[model samples]
Target chain A: MHELSIALSIVEGAGEEAARRGGKVSVVHLRLGQLSGVVKDALLFSYDLACEGTLLEGSRLMIEEEPVVVFCPECAAERALASIQSFRCPVCGALTPDVVRGRELELVALELTYEQHAASATPATTD
Target chain B: MNNTPHPPRLPRLIEVRKNVLKRNDLLARKLRDRFRAASVFVASLVSSPGAGKTAFLEKTLTALRAQCRVAALVGDLATDNDAARLARAEVPVRQITTGTVCHLEAEMVERALDGWNLDELDCLFIENVGNLVCPSSYDLGEEMRLVLMSVTEGEDKPLKYPTIFNTADVAIITKIDLAAAVEFDLKSARRNIQSVRPGMRVFELSAKTGEGMDEWLRLLQSRL
Candidate 1:
């Protein structure tokens, strides 16, 4: 239900970048984590509606789902949790509260398309 | 027909690598720094509707105000009923009315805090909109986050909404007075909370009957 607001934030972020770079946005890459509390399907559905009248209109949202990873004290290493229902280490079964990852709701990259201008020798500016 | 040739377009991939909640995170960080500078211990409460959040907060404000200056900000979709209830505690109270918004963002918390001198407060409590899901994704710049679940809710609440349990610093089992009436299994509730978030501090209390309130109040005072 909150995915629409999240999608709006994504569109706002990507739109700002697209405007600054002077190109039409083709794709938005996002990294979603299991512990981030965001559902991918809902986000995808909202992204389309959020982009209807924005710079990201017609742009595709590419989501990279990330699993929860915790730092096990007994194992002394980072391990992915087999089930988010439990935060225990899969190998040693030691419960760890130090979450190394899996709270990410980040926008990683964007694909932009620019029409080539023969008069201008410089290519599209990127930062 | 003679026409100018169209120029070929190329798609360029550029790395942005930014958090979608960066704006809220930044605002929360600023709020945290301000809280620290003002020497105010801030805590936020999240729970499903009718989980006794306002009742617990009302009792808390009433109890803590005697020892230290305590205040609260409550968020709800419509009514200011919670704020009205807490106001009886005779402490500073504010209500954030979020129409149609399911959760309280850091910006809303910041705006609600305007004109209030944090320096005069010893402790501040923010009661998030009664939601188990959406509120888990938001951080309100509190030093501690307490997620409440009434005994009547069910023992498997933590397992069902692990995300909220995972994000919270503490778990509170409210309405313990009704445990016997509702056949609420306290052991299973504790076990379920531990399963989702190991080493999480838990407080079982009833805001109505004053049962187990001393322990929770002691912890709250220690933080301040």
Candidate 2:
């Protein structure tokens, strides 16, 4: 599966982000789309292999699956597809090929642990 | 030892919002720039196993090499057979044997061009690993991406795997000579392709018989 490659990239990218932010990663948040051609279970299975002996070792992988949406030309409205494979419009029954979403494979956020919380909490300070 | 209470460390959330395929995309973009700078017209082919991608490529390479300098890079999981098959056309060919990976990434294509000079070649064909699902997500920096389907694969292949059709620049229906033998419905195949991506350019041909290959060659020539 290509998910292994994707997993490797995700872990590598997260490692860079962790090092730049000066913390150890605890969890990685991902936004996976239904039409992204990536299997979530397969990615999760390979996550451990990709993260072994790296900065992301033992870190949790959290995935948020995005739904596929298509813009129906006949209906002039956006439709959310129940089946990711088919692009038929839900209301108009016409095939809408204009995909607006569900191709996302983004690393949205990283949860990190710091030695001292107060020192790293810049937004919590009050004069 | 003095007993003192300490607060437990809490993890803080940091926003990344970076594309996971960014690394591959960036490399692919760099390759695109290189190809453009070298004045090379690159076309890539993708298909399911046994879709006759190598055969089509062999025919295309032989025909195109007559007037222009041509080279090819073929990918397979464990065999150099495809490379050998394309080499029969007497063009410079390389095989990228991806050990366990199902698809060829941009990095593999870049590495395969190590000894070859892109400026010397007028056209380059990258025949991807035989897979429809995984290869659809990868971009190999080709100017045109062709998705091949044989008459034996049935008409609803586009319906079953819309992602590949959506990603492809053109669809080639291969093995048309065997369409009648296989009872392949050409109308339904065309309809299915249209349903997936309206107004997509499609070509049908049989490399074995050279039927409809002239038109396909003309399309390639126009691109070059």
Candidate 3:
């Protein structure tokens, strides 16, 4: 499945972010849009397999699901798009309007739990 | 050498759970950068088996070659038949024979175009391995992507495989000559396409009859 590829990108991307932050990453957060063409279960299943040994090995994936939205031209209203494109408007029985968003495929950010040692009370070198 | 009841064999465990495809995506980004630099437009075609991608390519390659330098890479699970078919149109055509994979990835595409001058061509077409589901997941660094559903394939395919429709820039309804014979509903098919891709540009054509081919070629000319 393409999920395998996407999961790989997520782990690699998060791993890069974690390395850059110089911390141990605890979670990888993503926003999955309804029309992004990625299935959540497929991505989740592949994520675990994709994150096994990298810097983000134990990091958890947090996905925020976004609903499909459509603009209704007749009513000039924004509404949820029905699954399988049941496109008749709920209000007016007309074709639903264009899709403005809901196709996002992005890695928003990373959640890291870093250990910060307290600053040394005494300087090592006496000036 | 003495073996005392062979030491318990442990499975070699490497924490290699990463996706094997990331390498390809990296290469794809490089190719995309190259494409962006050169203004080379590319598109890939995807569909189920027998969706007329080869015939469509034949017609397209012939027309596009007349106007601009065009090339194509055709993928199939077994034979090089499609490649041969398109080569007859007198353009540079090659075949990628994936023995078992359901779809084509970026690496295969990268390898196919390797050592070639990308700026020499206006548009390149990659005919995917004829799968509706798996190809939706992979991006081939193409500026445009077209997913085709033949009239013989019925109108409900867009609903069945909305994921592919969602990924495509355009949808093509092929074999319109057979639409009436197959009882294909043009209205409902267009409605279905719109429902899946909302405002997606569509082209309906038949390569055999040359019906509607002119309109499709005109769009290709605009792209080049």
Candidate 4:
């Protein structure tokens, strides 16, 4: 599906950040929202294929799933939607289209590992 | 052992906080700015295959061309048939053949718009490849997005694909002429749409029978 392309973008984004920061990427952290229209399972399946032969190969993908949150005018507070099928406020049941969150498909962070070469390691800092 | 010392590698966690679709989103923002500068109204249509998107767009182009400079860009996995069909309206129409891509990205739209003077157009319509799910995630820099569902397609269509409905600015119930024959429940359809996206503007029309076209056209013109 479109998950492959999405996974490819993830790999590309993480790879760029790793390059800039100067390290081998060990893990990619992503924030995927419920209303982002992407299936987590499908994206996970595609991630390995997208990472093949890339800088992010053999890296683990950590996904943080985000639930849809909408602002309810009646409740005067933001509410997390239990189901995307209904956009009504959980507390007041008021139908509010004001989506405060849950469209996020962001690369939040990266786990990098730096290999210390023998020549670069100082005896004082080593245990 | 050698005098050289070796230390184990340490995993460092760094915050990168970036959007996965940032590239497309940036391009879309630029396109939106360009559209605003040119004083042109851009709208994109999304619907399931066989939901009468092309027919509605053809009717729209034909009607709007008489009043203003209008054009269209249609996307499909294959075949330029949609482009040819829209060309009957006698307005400039281009087809973006995505090959295997299920949705139209901002870059494809940007490339299709090349060599066209945005200043000469009052309104532009982009007909996305007909697939409800994938198209919901991509934004093509349109000022308005209309998600269509024909009467024959069950009233629960919105409930099934709430994300697309929520992302869309307007809901269009196409093939209204066949509603009675198909036992289409207009009330239920409207309720479902509102349940997923409250305060969404909706229009019920038939591109074939010319029913309810006036109201829809009025809204389009007002947007322009």
**Candidate whose DockQ is highest:** 4
Residue-level lDDT tens digits of model 3 in B1-224: 34333333222211222332456667778878888887788889999999999999899899888788889999888999999999999999988998877789888998888877988887899999988888876778888899999999999999898878877898889999999999999999998898776778999999899999999888877887
DockQ score, prediction 2:
0.51
lDDT of 1 by residue, B1-224 (tens): 23566467668898999899999999999999999999999999999999999999999999998899999999999999999999999999999999999999999999999999999999999999999999988888999999999999999999999999999999999999999999999999998899889999999999999999999999988888
Give stretches of model 2 more than 4 Å off. A74-77, A115-127, B1-6
Give the RMSD in angstroms, all C-alphas superposed, for model 1. Answer: 2.9
Decoy 3 TM-score against native:
0.75
- Cα lDDT tens digits, model 4, B1-224, are 56556567578789999999999999999999999999999999999999999999999999999899999999999999999999999999999999999999999999999999999999999999999999989889999999999999999999999999999999999999999999999999999999999999999999999999999999998888
lDDT of 3 by residue, A1-127 (tens): 5687678878777776555545566777787777776889999999999988788787788788878777788888887766735655567766753676676666776666544331122221233
The candidate 3 chain A region of ten consecutive residues with least summed lDDT is: A118-127
Q: What is the lDDT of residue A101 in candidate 4?
A: 94
Residues A22-95 of candidate 4 have per-residue lDDT tens digits of: 77889999999999999999999999999999999999899999999999999899999999999999998999
True-structure lDDT of candidate 2 = 0.90
lDDT, candidate 2, residue B77? 98
The total number of steric clashes, by the backbone 3 Å criterion, in model 2 comes to: 0
Model 3: how large is the Cα RMSD against the reference?
Answer: 9.6
Clashing pairs in 3: A49-B17
